[model samples]
Target chain A: MKKFLNDPVNFVDEMLEGIYAAHPMVTYVNDDLRCLVTAKPKAGKVGLTTGGGSGHLPTFLGFVGDGMLDGAAVGGVFQSPSAEQMYQVTKAVDQGVGVLYIYGNYSGDIINFDMAAELADLDGIAVKQVVGNDDVASSIVGEEHKRRGVAGIFFIYKAAGAAAAEGLSLDEVARIADKARMKTRTMGVALSSCVVPEIGHATFSIGEDEMEIGMGIHGEPGISRKKLGAADAVVDEMMERIFNETDYKSGDDVAVLINGLGGTPLEELYILFRRVRQLLDARGVNLKHVWIGEFATSMEMAGASISILHLDEELDRLMAAPANTPFFKHVTG
Target chain B: MKKFLNDPVNFVDEMLEGIYAAHPMVTYVNDDLRCLVTAKPKAGKVGLTTGGGSGHLPTFLGFVGDGMLDGAAVGGVFQSPSAEQMYQVTKAVDQGVGVLYIYGNYSGDIINFDMAAELADLDGIAVKQVVGNDDVASSIVGEEHKRRGVAGIFFIYKAAGAAAAEGLSLDEVARIADKARMKTRTMGVALSSCVVPEIGHATFSIGEDEMEIGMGIHGEPGISRKKLGAADAVVDEMMERIFNETDYKSGDDVAVLINGLGGTPLEELYILFRRVRQLLDARGVNLKHVWIGEFATSMEMAGASISILHLDEELDRLMAAPANTPFFKHVTG
Candidate 1:
């Protein structure tokens, strides 16, 4: 495999060491290297925590900072963090208020986080959980809750983190997070598969001239694979799936994110955003905010995803709230 | 070519359209589709304008926002923007104070920007220029002016933009920009070449097991091409060259940037940064700030560059100044 790595066996440890060395605002919680906590945690506020596999950056760790996640449990590439790691992070970040865990709706994450919550309960530290299920391509129309979580976790993190920063109770923060997840929809198109470091090869094979619509972040089988078409046409298919899954209406205010799956450049993300804007305008969907970059990604995967969040007044305000992290920073106007 | 594009001929125009559509804080100049200007220009402040080939994002266009560049003139992929385009952006951003032009030290860019400065001078708008020559591998010792600029343009933008935002005069801002450029040093390695959309093929070729050290952003020949080594060994070679070129002292404070050339994953970047931090620590060079991401990219090239800026007190404050752009946001403490 052509990768900038020393050894596949040490990839996770080296990456975590690098992350800790690079970011001064965050540090390991106690002796548990798997859990990273913000250095300056706000008092009398609900502690927000998230965890998942390592490949999707700016998801769990990148979101750990002021006005966002208070801590994160990082696992190996595409592998979920253990329940013990999550439990330690929960105990470390709880500032007498409580802690809320927000993560993607993957079976591994759900199982681990639930176990962590139960463990935390024994210590009298209240812990709430919200599993993001915004990937519309993962399930049928009436089974939105069964869908896999994707880039829409960004919206959930922003909304729930804002609520927590406002000193909301753990339950209230969880409610807002759940609301954000329900309103957000995402669909992805993969031009190529990503190689896991340990695997040393692509998780799946795709032809040069072919593309998979509705592919999961972990290379799960998508709705269909077809001849790769123009940028606008591929975006159109993704958008149609999202619209059909969500209750998007004319004149509704929304936030849009055109996310790159690692290998894609910002130039292509903007190209894809242009088509997204054109289609949304025709449908009378007002874009209140638009983010175009790699918020979450599969390691070196060449593709993109579109995520739309139907914003209410509260959601709009929360989305606009200030956040300062390694990967994301939003200053309040 | 496997790319997410529509018509190769219209790639630049379409990308600009997408940028203007996605960012509400920036708008195209009147009658100049290639020029992007901030919607709300701070009056009396020296206008900061930057431009170059279109492929390196967050370098030019992504730096145009509040507390950053007042305007950007975008060009075709790996092709410099015309003199007329730069002239138009200069005219749009100048607010009677003056304008400072900061761009990479490339033949086409220097020629075009110089022409535009002359044109602006005819219209009574004072224009000062600072050509970035931070790529240490591009030239020999005492010939820094002949070196090409790479990821170090990011430091130039932050320092000069901060100076201008502080209401410094044109000459002062230009002086600060020049100082930033002089203090910055960068070295890059490339595992693969980037493809220009119109070219429909890689700009250069290398063997699967080979890597090019000190390669330019636009596929210029590097110092050497050899068998790819481990990540730490590669980083050590790059850092040794940087230390040899610059007089980095034991107690000197420096800002570090590990920039991905579009296709490298964040995991690898941090892994690289881990070694960079170790080398600097052993040398006793204090790292005051660190940034790791795709700052200046070559479309979708799979590699990375290291930039080190030896910072004094003034440079430190300016680097920490508040700036809010799509790709970069530094919140003042």
Candidate 2:
């Protein structure tokens, strides 16, 4: 595997160190650097805490800041962090309005966050949660809850962060987050597998002329594997899959995020976005806002994902709110 | 080569089309979409225009916007735009205050831009220019002008963009850009080669376990090709080379950009950033500001570059000035 690292085992912590060193406003909530919390905490506002594995920059930890998530419990590359770490973050950011756990729908994260919620309950801190299951490729219609979360977590974070910043109650904030998760859909394709440092090899392999459509970020199986197609055909398939799984139709307004899975050039992303825009217009969908970049990544994997958020009144308003995260410095609605 | 594209020849144009569709604030200055200019131009403010090859996004076209650049002339992948296209941009952006052409240093770009400047002179638009040559490994200190411009152009862009925004004259804006370029130094390492779409193969290649230190953005040979080392050691050598090429002393303040080449993970960029931070701090170099991300790329090549901009007071203020570009949304000094 080709990559850069010191010790494979220290990959996660070193990355966190680099992040902590670069962002002056970021600090660990406790002795563990993985338990990251913003130095600026709004006491009266509903605090949001997310926990997930590393490898996805700006997904969980990168979103921890003003107008976004307040704290995050980070794990190793595609590995789960401990429940104690999540509880530490929950405790640190719980500024009396209670804490809301908004994270991916993964068993590791769910168990750890639920345990953290129990620990918070013992401390008389109310906790609510919204699990993101927006990857349409992972499950069929009416089985969205069984689907995995992907880059679409960005929408949920932005919407829920804005709701919490408005001083919403914990339940209201969680409701908003849950609603955002329900409205978002993502589909990805993998051209190359990302090399995890500790593993020192690709998590999986594909033929030179092959690609896996609807592949999960962590190399999970996809709905289809075939000869790599053109950018237009690939984007068409992705958007078609997303539309089939949703109630998106003519005259619907939506926001779009074209996420690069680490290795794709930004140029290709815009190319993908161009076709998506054309497809949406052809189908009478009104594309309102667009964010094109590496919002979520899979550690140098050569691929990309398209996330469509069917925006409603609340999501439209909240998406427009300003967020000052280290990663999405200009990701306003 | 594994990539997403319809036809190799249509790559650059399709990418530009995607950019045009995604950013409504952006438009072609002429019939040719390669000559792009911002819709919002500040009358009486010195206009800044740049042009270069296609693969390096944000390096040229992505930097065109308010507080960054007024216009940009794009070209085919790793190929220079025509002089006429650059002249189109220069004329469109020059709202009677003159135009400053800031771009990377390369034979093709230099020759074309010089031709464009001569044409602008004929039009009496008062054209000035600043050529970026900050890649320390491309040339020695005594012959710095022979170096290649890499990620360090971001500093020049930020500084000159701010200067132009402040209503500086063309000459004054060029001065600031030149000063920024002079104070900046950069070094890069490539773990893998980038594939040009039309070429349909790698521009160059290295061993699976070997890396070339100081590789140019377009796969120019570096000073050394050896087995890949740990992140810390590679970063240390890069920093050591940069320090050797400049007179960066203790107590001096600086800004940093840890740029990821196309295929390197953001995590690795941070790992590199962490070492740079420690190296500077230990040398009594006052690290005041930092911008870390894929500021520049080499078309999915696995590598990164570190740019160090020694900041003076004016440079510091200008770097902090607000820039609303499609890329670098939060990159204030």
Tens-place lDDT per residue, model 2, A126-167, is 999889998888998887789998899999999999999999
* Per-residue C-alpha lDDT of model 2 across residues B167-255, encoded as one tens digit per residue: 88788898899999999999999999999999989889799999999999999999999999899999999999989867778999999
Q: What TM-score would candidate 2 get against the native?
A: 0.98
Assess each model's interface with DockQ, reporting 2 decimals per model: 0.79, 0.76
Quick one: how many clashes does candidate 2 have?
Answer: 3
Q: Candidate 1 chain A: worst 10 consecutive residues by lDDT?
A: A240-249
Tell me each candidate's TM-score: 0.98, 0.98
* Whole-structure CA lDDT of model 1: 0.90
Displacement of residue A64 (Cα, Å) in model 2 is 1.4
lDDT string for model 1 (B1-333, tens) is: 667889988888888889888877888886776888998888898999999989888777998987789999888898899999999999999999999999999999999999999999999999999999899889998888799989999999999999999999999999999999989999999998888999989999999889999999999999999999999999999999999877888999999999999988899999999999999999899999888999999998999999999999999989888999877888866
